[model samples]
Target: MGKVTLITGASRGIGYALALEMHMRGHHVIALARSEDKLQALKAECNDNRMECAVVDLGQPAQVDQFISALVDRGYTISHMINNAGALVNKPFGEISASELRHVYEVNVFSVFELIQKAMSVFADDIHVVNISSMGGFQGAQKFPGLSAYSSSKAAVASLTECLQEEFGEKGWSFNVLCLGAVQTEMLAEAFPGFKAPVNPSEMSTFIADFTEGAQKFIRGKVLPISSTTP
Candidate 1:
């Protein structure tokens, strides 16, 4: 079988750009997101048989399970898996509701756990799992206000990546987390309006694509901070 790459949140921002980059690099790319129209737009842009679009809401555990099951039924083995989908709530800690907290964790943390667990059956021997986190989740990194739910969930994701690496590194599977800083993406705009980030989604996606493809050989169970500015 050929190499297949699965990218979540591929409807927009870094996820979108990363999907395109992987497709261009000749990987059978599976672009997944909740928006069907946006996924269609990505499919239209790709216009290639190598790219497959799936509308999946990562927050829904059942949807995530079905997605992995479909991939297995189709005999597709994932070579690279990018957990790039995230949920952000710009509310102060006290004001953050339980539902809001659950939503954030569902997308940023729980869904990642479920997806990776289910995808194991369809994973290639040399699979590389790249979990996208935030600089706010990085230890000693600057923290921001009104992001208690989002940031804490991201931190959980980073920690999970480390544990997974420790458990699976002996199997030769690579797991890493990239704690990114501000990037000119819709999420950043929502979190900090009118703030122009130094790096754009496309540039960041390029770097992520390179790192996902080559960094696994040199790094595993590592949490690398990818930032040039304070967000």
Candidate 2:
């Protein structure tokens, strides 16, 4: 078996594209998502011997436990992990509910931690972790009114990425924080429809998978103007 890559939210959009790219590159793609049917379809389309699926809800502890248990039972070892599962809610800061905030953190930040915990069990000497932060991660960025919850969660993740970088870099484990601008994804379309950012998610996925190969490197940024305006 080739090196295994664990990708959360791999059923569609960026995660899905990333999985396909890696799978085509001869890497074992371990797809995880809430939609088993979608993952199944993806597996069938790729038909690559390295492609596999594990239905998981990044926000739920029970689901993650079950998925990891199955992987271990099957002697699966994960080498690369992209904590990409996330959801966005647009509401006034004062109107956002405590439950809603918890839900966002559960998937965006918490799930990444749990998956890393599980990944350590089957870690190789060289491992790369890419945490998908947002342009809002940078200090002094305009977080906007409705996205207080999401922007805050992404910021917290960026901070966590820094801590991880310092702690793990010395040991040769690398973690990078990728702050993306608007990309052509369902979530992006819903978030900002009329003016879509020029960053194509499919291309972004390809860049990320190709960039993250070996060694632990720390790349941090905030408010990356990823729109075509720059390029």
Task: Please give the lDDT score for candidate 1.
Answer: 0.93
Residues 45-142, candidate 1, lDDT per residue (tens digit)?
A: 98978999999987777888888889978999999999999989998899999999998998999889989998899988999999999998998898
Which residue pairs of candidate 1 clash?
none
Q: TM-scores across all candidates?
A: 0.98, 0.89
Best by lDDT: 1
lDDT of 2 by residue, 1-231 (tens): 558898888888889988888888778989999998999988998986789887777777787778878877878776777878877887888998999999988888888878877667766556777777776655665566678778888887878877876776666566776777677788776555565667777899877787666424434322233334311
* lDDT at position 65, candidate 2: 79
lDDT of 2 at 175: 71
In model 2, what are the clashing residue pairs, if there are any? 138-222, 174-216
Local lDDT at 57 for model 1: 85
